[model samples]
Target: MHPPDAPGTEPCDWSWETAADPDEVHALLTACDAHQATASGTPAPRRRPETTRWLVESGSVHLLRHTTGPAGMFTLTARPPSGTDESVFPPAEHPLYLSRLAVAPAWLAGGALVGLRCVRQAVETAAGLGGDTLRAQVNPDLRDTCSLLDLLGFTPCGPASADETGRRHAHLHRPLTAPAADRRGD
Candidate 1:
């Protein structure tokens, strides 16, 4: 993978791996949450270990790591064509929800480009899953993630509201591919 922000000639050999074991996936989630909490100075609300395990069992837990170690991760889930309430999300025949995404500050240190690349990977993954639209729920308080999503073509779809944890969140949507005619600079 390209380290979009690395200086000239700097090698950025990042990789993606699917965590096959529940225990391994749990450790990855723990480490990622710890890293995010430390980096953002906001303790992430702890998620149930069973929930993490369930995600792994569902075959959605994918890991992103640099040559050195874990750099980022994300999980995806399919959305119904009709979607949820209109006040919350728009309709789409094929959509994938970016259920969770987190990048370690060490990776961000490379540059915003690193974060962008990771998110783009998520978009590409959605496209591969036959998704036409990609959806995400971003907590307004998480400026870094919000910024990254906005920079990568995701647009805010609605106003902010409290999630299950009562934390305010804004919905974001991104089209998986540009129209064919638009690709040629039409």
Candidate 2:
């Protein structure tokens, strides 16, 4: 998917795209490295030089680039997990899980609002592909993220049920039926 073609400060109009037929979905996860760094204060997930190849080969990645303009283009793609056959999600209800979401520093001008919009688009796109729910996990300690999740219509699955990751994450869910406009103030 290409980003917003218009030149502006708004989040590079988010959409899905793929190039070179890398067999897997590709996204600009490295940009989010800053977010991860601030939270963890460490860069554990190093970007391999050949990551694009790996991303293309093992996942159904979708890329979001800032339109067909400019040179500092940033793209974000989500890929399915490996061995994703155990039915973690219902085929007809949750066909695709939002494995990753990232944006370049320059494109985060709209703040969390842009993120919610991206989620809405992805959910709608997934629904069109026969999905009902979009599931994702966020670190619980990241106070900044909870409000975003709440704004996006995600309720915590409670502390007990989501303690698998050192009790640091809360399972979040979003349904396609919720109007994208109503996703806020939920």
Report, for every candidate in turn, its global Cα lDDT versus the true structure: 0.69, 0.49
- Give per-residue CA lDDT, model 2, range 1-186, as digits (tens): 223434463553444554344322223455554655566554324445366565545443455544432112222234343322323333333435664555554545334244555565666666776655666655555565567668867665444233323434455666666555677855
| Local accuracy of candidate 1 as per-residue lDDT tens digits, 108-129 | 5555455566688888888998
Worst lDDT window (10 residues) for model 1? 79-88
Q: Which stretches in model 1 have alpha-carbon errors above 4 Å?
A: 1-12, 34-43, 79-87, 109-114, 163-166, 178-186
Name the best candidate (by TM-score): 1
Total backbone clashes of candidate 1, pairs 3 or more residues apart or in separate chains? 0
* Model 1, TM vs. native: 0.75
TM-score of each: 0.75, 0.57
